[model samples]
Target: MRHSRILADVGAALRFYSRIPVPAGAAEDAFAPPNLKRIAYAVPLAGAVIGLAGAAILIGAHALGLPNLVAAILAVLTCVLLTGALHEDGLADTADGFGGGASRLRRLEIMRDSRIGSYGACALVFSLLLRVALLDGLLALSPTRAALALIAAASLSRAAGMLLLEFLPPARADGASAAAGQPGADAAVRSALVGALLATLLIVPSTGVGATLMAIGLSVLALFAMTRLSNRLIGGQTGDVAGAVQQLCEIAFLMGVLIYARPH
Candidate 1:
């Protein structure tokens, strides 16, 4: 039935995107990447869940008398744990490939390597630092705004990844992205629309129309640049590229919020 497929797809998204458990017997069936591609819209929905959990951690940490920096670090650590550092790993791998590898083929080879390199180490370090710094700023400014920003950033960032999947073919024929297959253009667009709608609603209520527009504009531009960078370096997208997009786009979104979501 159509309903069953939707539930299966939701389960698939959670399994792929988070450390959240799926129904025990359904795990294997939910992750047939082909089936997942059909319902890839669930990506943003899964992100919303992950972000809410992280935001809750932030709130609880602050409530327990933690410093803003400490609470922010705990919140980031919670997300890293909950998602099993899924996008973070992709980011580190992409940095290593793009920064350290000399040739396109070599870049792909580096990304596929299991070991982290110097570039990977540096990328992860800065990513954590930037994320914590941004969240700490937001927390100091207004915890409520920070919570909303977390949800919007998480959803919209994944939407940015969906756009890359829509526009770029897999960088390698045998890679995970190629094996999983990309979403159809229409499906990808629809997913993005859903994500944008959610993000806009989350922001506009608190930040007003102007700030909401700024956040969306910044997120799109950042995604665009990341896509072009991937294309120039590796010819197209891979899972690591998508992951990098998610991480950078999320940071951009949060920064946009921090810039524009001030008391009015």
Candidate 2:
């Protein structure tokens, strides 16, 4: 691909996945909705950039003598802010829809509602708690390793979420996912490959090849489970489902890495 096309794809991925403002001059139609079909393969690159931003906050907080837990929270908070809690909102909505609705249609409606239900609230709390705890534990081992883990998890989770776009039809005729369109198998495969390469390179030096492979395997398993549950519950994929799966895979990846990582 030409450099301009590659840059456009990267910009589109960041525009869709983050709150960061791309320069208007980058493209004539910069304000147009991102084309996910071409952009999906570049999503992992956007994720790695976001991870770098979060890692900066994390390392800076730790360097200032903040507690590891506090540093982790701040780092996560930075990521949430950068992404406008985009994935977290999806996770909350998915939890509410799946837990409270009676049918596929009703579930989609529940997910679209802006109001937070008990199920949504509980899901958000638990997700945040687990992420913070996992990051804290990793930080306790080594700040550098923890930073790299954040990058790997971010990139891999987004890549895993692409499986839904590749394998499942959209549940609704209208919505962000439907509007953006499903990514082609080629784009999805490229995404997975890029995410895996970035994750392996970042994780192996600190966690070793065995732990990195284990983490990747567990992440794939989590992705598969989420894919099955979403299909069963909603009849297809949605933007919310994608977000929820990404969150789940990230947690699974962290758990796998933390279980095997040792202090160096």
Candidate 3:
């Protein structure tokens, strides 16, 4: 019975994050240790799957001589579908909090609001534009490279979010970050290492020495900035901060790739 309960908890965690719907009463079940592990592990796995899907779409488009614009649009759609637009919501909420709210409490309040604000609107526009541009450039290089880049970016970004969750205190008593805080340190460490290894595999082989170095440098810069931002806002990191970190890291990685690709 105990073992069955653990499995049920794992299923519930998976359903909470995935596109699947959680049935009524599932939330009443206590989160089991195995279930926590499942949730921690599932995050990067899902990102990898999404990345692979995006790569497939890009490759198919290239093979059929589909326009870059069309390929880019499809890739964005793929990401949206796979993640269920969760990260986008985080980005928007973060933007609203930072841009318009004057205090920590106010920021939290603004973030909770479902309606989009001007800051969120602008942030979404810029994020989408940059993602599409970077992805298009990557596709132009090679379908294989594009695929690897997407996979690496998706995995690493989520891993980065996990890292923030592990290190930082949750801002709200009730929220995703607080819920994720239940995971043990050892499990979190293992998850982080796996995510980092996967990201390294994707970037190092195709990017070569200069690009890899640039990516590392940019990743460090992003981490530092995010740490500072997290500290300033709400006294620590929230779920939204984690999402913002991922989004920023994605942009940073793309910028690194672009800079390395630049001609002398």
**Which candidate's TM-score is highest?**
2
Stretches off by above 4 angstroms in model 3 are: 1-16, 20-42, 182-185, 261-264
Clashing residue pairs in candidate 3 are: none
Model 1 segments more than 4 A misplaced: 1-7, 24-28, 34-36
> Global CA lDDT of candidate 1, please?
0.85
RMSD of 1: 1.9
TM-scores, one per candidate: 0.94, 0.96, 0.83
TM-score of 1: 0.94
Residue-by-residue lDDT tens digits, candidate 1, 1-264: 387766666667778778798773434664455443576687887788888898999999988999999999998898889899999999999999999999999999999998999999998999889889999998887888788888888888887888898788899998778877888888788778878898889988877777677778888998899889999999999988899899998888888888886764
User: Candidate 2's C-alpha lDDT?
Assistant: 0.88
TM-score of 2: 0.96
Q: How far out, in Å, is residue 54 in model 3?
A: 1.4
* Global lDDT of each candidate: 0.85, 0.88, 0.71
TM-score of 3: 0.83
lDDT of 2 at 70: 99
Taking the tens digit of each residue's C-alpha lDDT, what string does model 3 give over 4-107? 55445445543554454444244555343224455565556556666777778877877888987678778877776766777788888889998899999999
lDDT of 1 at 67: 98
> What RMSD does each model have against the real structure?
1.9, 1.3, 4.4
